[model samples]
Target: MACCDDTCAPFDGASPAYRRALLAVIAINATMFATEVAAGLGASSRALLADALDFAGDAATYTITLWAIGRPLRTRATAALLKGLSLALMALWVLATTAWQVVVQGMPRAEVMGVIGLLALAANLASVLILVRWKDGDANVRSVWLCSRNDAIGNVAVIAAAGGVWVTARAWPDLVVAAAMAGLFLTSSVKIISQAAAELRAAAAAA
Candidate 1:
């Protein structure tokens, strides 16, 4: 399904202010991606690693959106389609890695997980606030908003996983959370691809 309802107006991709906002969000995501990846490795938390990948993917998506802005509608829709495929691929990678970690790794550090997850949550919340006004935009813009929204939600889940691991002294919570995050990625990507596909079809019909 599309991100916006039928009542919403078409997205304004040419807005200079919107482009500037996206640039800020891209920087935030890229910075968070580096921090989360390092922390995820140090803490040995699959959930953190998954979230790091998400941050990286979002950064790339926004970059693509920036490039496609002020271009043809078909071009923007194409970029969204590519971004959706990339997200899906990343989700599969996370799922595979999570499964491997479950089979081979021990419990991760709950304290580290909690601390880094909190940091990530803060970063994503800021991004969400910046992009909240564009949540109902066209497929390309809406995909960016969805990425921020999902990252925020995933960060909360990571914190919950940390708490669960701390209480139980087990890795199951971390693994489960990673798996759930992968599921979120998959579902959101499918939604984005569907919307982008519809937009492409409409653009074609109009031409």
Candidate 2:
């Protein structure tokens, strides 16, 4: 019974500290989402908009994670499954937007893209540092870590795309980066879903 209790405890019974970290991350991600979306629209950068959407998705996922804390393993797993679905939807939306931009938009403002991308990187890095300790926790906690990790990676790609656009004066780089970020979202969602499903199965078996 004690072993089962240990296995099921959210954040390994450090829910209080974990919840504080998540709250901070949620605030950072939410703020960055708003700022990046405005910059994305103003600069007409599909990649920037895609990353902004990712930030929004992460913020929501973190909120879900916060809700799951201190709950039973089954409850947390269910919350993670919902987060995974949301991530998949976000990827699909980004892919569609990228396609539309490919057909309609020209080269985005390279300067704006580079600057905003850098700012987003800083924000995500801060969140990553805050959540680094709990990166190996349960599915719900790991999902939050995965989101921040992917966001940091995507931020780097966005910066690279900005540089590519600056050098080539072309729209292809931005569209390519947007597609890549969509791929990241899809991949991470699969991982999160699998982990959550596994937890659910284990919980059922124990029951």
Which is the leading candidate under TM-score? 1
Clashes of each: 0, 0
The CA lDDT of each predicted structure is: 0.78, 0.76
- Candidate 2 lDDT, 1-207, residue by residue in tens: 001011222454446787788789889989988898788878888888778766776676667656765679899788877767777787787788789888886769999999999999899778778877766747756655555565677888889999999999999999999888777667767777788889999999999
For each candidate, give its TM-score against the true structure.
0.78, 0.77
In model 1, residue pairs whose N, Cα or C atoms come closer than 3 Å (at least 3 residues apart or on different chains), thus clashing, are none
Window of ten residues with lowest summed lDDT in model 2: 1-10
Question: Candidate 2: lDDT over CA atoms?
Answer: 0.76
Q: Which segments of candidate 1 are over 4 A away from where they belong?
A: 1-18, 129-150
What is the per-residue lDDT of model 1 for residues 51-159, given as tens digits with 9 covering 90 to 100? 8867876686667667864689899788878878877887788798889888896779999999999999899878778877866637646665665565677888899
